[model samples]
Target: MRKTDLLAALALSAAAVLPAAAADEVNVYSYRQPELIDPLFEAFTEKTGIKVNSVFLNKGMVERLKAEGRRSPADLVFTVDIGRLNELVEADVVQPVRSATLEANIPAAFRDPEGRWFALTARARVAYASKERVKDGEITTYEDFASDKWRGRICTRSGAHPYNLALTAAMIAHHGEQATEEWLRGVKANLARKPQGNDRAQVKAVWAGECDVAIGNTYYMAKMLADPEQREWAESVRIVFPTFENGGAHMNVSGVAMTRSAPNRENALKLMEFLVSDEAQRLYAELNAEYPVKPGVPPSELIRSWGEFTPDDLPLVEIARNRPAALKLVEKVDFDG
Candidate 1:
């Protein structure tokens, strides 16, 4: 062949490669707020040249995934809360991904045995109390939330919220139905006001002197320090990991799973593996302010500053399994108060 003919053939081959390169993009459905996750998305794309197209929502992703079904354009699901992840698995919207890298990065406690979903970060339902009003050694466990000293002085988000509901489920897992009911009754009697708002609001209530003790995830305290207006809300309160006295602090997860009908299965697995990789794990910590599920990955300096403690190793799937019973118990105990 002539030199000119060879050059023309090479140019045709390059043209054929362009579309596949462009198709490297992955579509994602995320329950995380965009502002919280977009930076990481940008970073992933920068590193791998795989563009990310995502839909962000605060509610109803499982139903949406069901509606989308096999025809779903979404290739991945990213969500908060083990209950939601389990719901996706039970609904058959997410399929198991057998990625050795993900299995290696995430601890057994943070992932489904079937690999349907894997947690990227962890958050604890901890106690926050007045820096001056509640002495350091005065409270050390979730059981302490029920004591009469905190009665009429505790604040919290609605028990119906997934975070609280999951924590309630953890209680059921550890103490049995009867004991959990009594504990809820005690916590209800102690409410400073009706359960309302997000975790940050609970800290605000403590700062305003509306309450002395509140329940919130450890990360919300970091959120407070990051937001100028809310930094002081966290000021008057110190985070206390409720080590359960008998077990460990109740924990929840933010995790990801592949769509049941992912069109780009190989790329989906790649993304999942990348997410659990050391570099991505560090980015997850910096951007999200939650503890990394990858055992050796350090969390944001803020999270580390909050101090470290043992996490309750309860199979998180159990919390998801008992969510319905937990919600029922919450109603029975009138935790809505």
Candidate 2:
């Protein structure tokens, strides 16, 4: 064969071998419920011809990944809350991938600056008040919950709850630790009853007339509204969009990251890109009742019905960053008391 022709043939052979070198399946460790995240996985596989094998767990994924170490088959990690994602990154379990697609789709406030993770969806932590008992235009912000007027009328889950912990962290980030502690004290003084139960229970307290107001994630209301048995729990309350006195509502995210030792690196990246795309962002909203992180994607009907407001815009990383100190504050205040 002529030298030029032979070289071209070898290049074609190398190109053919490249596909074979890639991993056939991507293993995922996901904190999302299977039902909520499965459609996106199926769509990704269908489009890219890369099979996804996932272990869905509500918790303990971080410890599992640590235990497995380099022997782990996981190529990607997914979870709600910046703290969990930050925990994985801080543990050296996640690797950074600087993808322009990720940067463009997700806001800087919702992602790790180092590219360690990208938030896929956002949910506001806002208050729900009784339509009759709580006067409209009375409670305009989270800070107001500390006022004496709200004493014996406010309800909230324990501060130790991850959701409330994150919100408290945000408060500390914005108001300073001293001010945040003071706010907590005032809020505590107003609690109709001791902080207890999951966020859903707080809303139920509103329904039972035990409290006039409750703080919870936006999605919890949707969950309650959808369940026939829990309709009564949702019916008595109306969502109040708290402006937080000056800043917007406090928000947090569900995020995704590639494992540091990801065997299916390329496919893992493809899945990450697919997740932040407009189509998938909308799916995230529709399936999970959370706000899309991507700009311009309209929120699901449940969220829209609750009305729109500006988000707090405090960098979400701070929520994770302040977690330790926030927990300390929660402990010092005896938030469960």
Candidate 3:
């Protein structure tokens, strides 16, 4: 990895604050990996003279920016999941934006209502069930995990993982906290083994005959299919879009937000607007295997093959607001312990 791909640390000196040499540049603090975003940056620079200097952080983005105070070099932040985006908003490290282009490109359900964040890509939290062991329509909703039918057959990562937490948060948005709590306990009781590994690992366990079903993001299927080693895992299962009892499928996003202390405000906003452009949306599908936030910009061929379904239209802010409750519910159930 390049030196720019540094993890989160308050190690930057005053001089290090300037991510690029030129004045017409945007410094990005991103949780999205460098490889996933470098192509987009190259395209942006090619189209406009504004340079993009990005540092990828795996964790603690809100804390780092808060510690940097008004001196933080970040002009924009790109991160996965609404939970992290909400953290930036709550920390007051990022400010709301107003851009006609962005507003036009992104759907209301996908972007922050206040414009504090805009989604660049969307991923559905779908079930991966064994094609051989699980029959058609065996599981059809998020609530199905708690049923006696799936006991000791469901696999997932830690409930505290942001992805699972987001799903839990969505559950809170659809059902009240009290109901979500009971549901969590039920789901916990159904775990095939102690919740372990990444989403792919869950799918692997399913393929390995350890579980009949796993919960994971849609993009993981495309990613695993592209990898020679993981392709069999991808092929061994079928993607199943599950709904909330009262809502459609649960969805998550890879989002962008503007830093509160943007030195290159104009350039930063320009980069953000450009990210939602049709061209960037297409690249997002090609490079990241993610669905675009902009309508009419089709997903990559491999992504299209996975099929589509209606994502729950619940506004992301509602789900984001429930993150704390979701975390608390996870802890209450001792889901990971």
Candidate 4:
């Protein structure tokens, strides 16, 4: 279906499930799947007595909001990836939030300096190495993906994918464009096959013996382990938190922003503050298998079992700014070809 039509259908589905508008309620336009966020919303409503209405859009959230202008029903926006969050800021669809609660709960590295967006959870871009073929420390840094040692033994999704692009942007932030381009070419030369499928698919390739190591997010390990059909694939690989030469693991976030045209401004601010609370952070960590952006909140036991590593201190906005250059390098390398 066309993107517009698909968004409309998703809106209708959300409307059909939501109750009639309540006197005290907040509306959300989310790129996150409903199942992943509904529990948190339910808990918020139960505690605060403010209803939460959400429309799950697969894409075009900024466009929809721009089109809706001052009449938009959305009070908040939620999405994965710094790139998407940056798009909201760039389009001026979201306004700055100045919640002391949010600033206190979240670290400086994970939030917008201007308070335009705040990360709810974090996930590292890690390596999934074959337990049988790759040693515990065989893959140490993301730079290792381009080493001659792993040629024809690496698997990843399209380099242009937001997840990969974010990583690429980070490389640029650290190594400069020309060097990052060289690194991209080297990594591309190492691909086991044409870039295909999701992060899970890359791990499945390792399980199938098509590759020795794959690039993917840390959360996928937990997700695969929970799925009955994909358990073997999860078991076949060990999670490796690779870092830059002198930096820590590469991390990305799923974040929230307040809409500029928030109709329920007061309730929306309340929800925003609530999302950073210990209860909400725990729910996010446990339910989604993500690292809580709020310090002092523990991740799920399953995620903890994978081990931990320091996250790179590079500001996410820098990553977002470097994205266009990263995409150009991906095209210049023809990474998926």
Candidate 5:
């Protein structure tokens, strides 16, 4: 079925399960998987007596919200990646939220200047180095991936993927366009094979002796370790927190935004505030194996085991702004081909 059709069916199913006009309820259009977020919703409902209804969309969330216009049932939109949040802001479908609780809980670096969006959790773009083939301290920075020593020894997903694009954008933020392009060319030259598969697949390649290092997110290690089939792959590589020359490790986020056509604005605000609470932050960190955006809240023990590094201070807005240039460079370099 088409993505829109599937979204419509899921919306209808959600409506059937929960009252359409419930007096105390909030609706969400989320890109996050239900299993990853339902527990938080349940906790919110239990604590506040507010019903939470959600529709999961794999793609086309901004288009769907645009189509619904003022009648859209969505109160909040949940998604990962700054590029996606910027899309909602650019579409003018989300409104600015002024909440003291949010400002105090989330750091200034992780939120929008105009209060249009707030990040909930953070993940780093890191390397999964083969335990046997890669020695400790051999890889310490993202720039090392482009070194001649790594030629034919690295693996990654498609350059066009949002995750890779964000990383590329960060490169541009650190080094100007020409230098970033050169860096891209160098990294492309090091690929063991054509850029293919998701982040986990890169790690699997390392396990299969296809490459010495795989570029991926930190949470995937926990996820792979949890799955019995991929446990061997998880065990074969160790997470490496590479930095940007003088800066720290590169970080990305999963964030939330309040929609403009919020029918239950009050309830939505309540949920938004609740999501950043210490309790909720802890739940999110433990459940998703992510680093919570809230200060004083710790990540799950499993996540902490991967070790820690200072996060890059480069603002996410800069990364989002550089996305167009990043894509153009990717195409120019033909990183995927």
Candidate 6:
């Protein structure tokens, strides 16, 4: 081959081999919004010198991961709701994480039995009552909504939403399916309007005098209060952490998992451990307004001012297991109707 031709052939022969993640890099597939979680990742990178790549997804995490198969670039999966996390586990896309740091920081109830997932933060499903209309101690328990006293006075989003489904599934755990069915029917009877809008909308309903109270997640109060436009909506309602007659307040989680196809397993596990560290937990409470998963780390000032209560000890796995039945109950009751 001539010199120019030989050079061209050699350059062509040098295939561009796409390497896996660099030694100091980890990739994440997340269902949570990037803005809410970016700070945590940024902090992780700052402290550990590991580059974190995040892919945000609203749907199809399982399908995408399944499609990627063993060649998937995802090292960790971050998502909210036990239902979605369980979907990953059920789909067999995530592998068990055998980290002592994870086991030490996370409670057994919040960790999967086989160690496939770990709860990083928790949110309680609580009631939001109109400050003007509802008495301070009038509704103190989840069962209170089932009383005729709350009839035509309560508001909530669709019962089948994963948040509500997890809460309902908890009801089934504490009370039998039969009794939970009765309680749900009673709660449905009390709807101030058609099961509509989101957790924020339910609070907005309370502000508009459309309802006396609404059932929603505890963190939403901080979120609403943070927004200038929604301040009035937040101010109109008081958070009520309602306990079950037989258990603590129902809670849900946003969690993390190691992908079965992780190419950077050590760095991925480092990121996981960092996430559960005190610095990261503090950032989570302060930035995202979520309750930290690590013990001894208190929530932000806003959450503390809301008062403290025991989170129900029912394992999230137990709650997730009942999601199908919970959805069936929501449909059976025609809750959204």
Best by lDDT: 5
- Candidate 5 lDDT over residue span 1-337, tens digit each: 9877865765555445433445789999899999999999999999999989988888888887776667678889999999999999999999999999999999988999899999999999999999999999999999878999999999999999999999999999998899899999999999999999999999999999999999999999989999999999999999999999968999999999998988888999999999999999999878888999998998988998899889998899999999999999999999999
- Summed over model 2, clashes come to 0
**RMSD in Å for model 4:** 2.4
Sorting all predicted structures by TM-score, with the top scorer first, yields 5, 4, 3, 6, 2, 1
Candidate 2, position 133, lDDT? 94
lDDT by residue for model 1 (1-337), tens: 9755654554343234322223588777799988877877887888888887777757766666665556666778899999888889988999887877887888888999999999988888888989978887888888778889888999999988899999988888888899989999999999989999998898899999899988898888877887899988888888888887689989998999998867767767778888888888888877778888897878887788877789999989889988999999998877885
lDDT for each residue of candidate 6 in 1-337, tens digit (9 for 90 to 100): 7655654443232212223667999888899899989999999999999989887778777877776677777899999999999999999999998989999999999999899999999999999999999998998889878999998999999998989999899999998788889999999999889998899999999999999999999889988998999999999989989999999999899999999989899999999999899989999767778899999998988899988899999999999899999999989989999
Candidate 4 residues lying further than 4 Å off, grouped into runs, are: 1-22
Worst 10 residues of 6 by lDDT: 10-19
The segments of candidate 2 whose C-alpha lies over 4 angstroms from its true place after superposition are 1-22
By TM-score, the best candidate is 5
Give per-residue CA lDDT, model 3, range 163-197, as digits (tens). 99999999998888998999999998888999989
Candidate 5: 10-residue stretch with minimal lDDT: 13-22
Root-mean-square deviation of each candidate, in angstroms? 9.9, 10.2, 3.5, 2.4, 2.3, 7.5
Tens digits of per-residue lDDT for model 2 on 257-325?
Answer: 987778788888889999998888998788999999999999977789898788998898888999998
By summed lDDT, which 10 consecutive residues of candidate 3 come out lowest? Answer: 2-11
Choose 1 or 3, whichever is better by lDDT: 3
Displacement of residue 283 (Cα, Å) in model 4 is: 0.7
Pairs that collide in candidate 2 are none
Candidate 5 segments exceeding 4 Å error: 1-21
Worst 10 residues of 4 by lDDT: 13-22
Better of 3 and 4 by lDDT: 4
Whole-model lDDT for model 5 versus the true structure?
Answer: 0.92
Q: How far out, in Å, is residue 130 in model 5?
A: 0.3
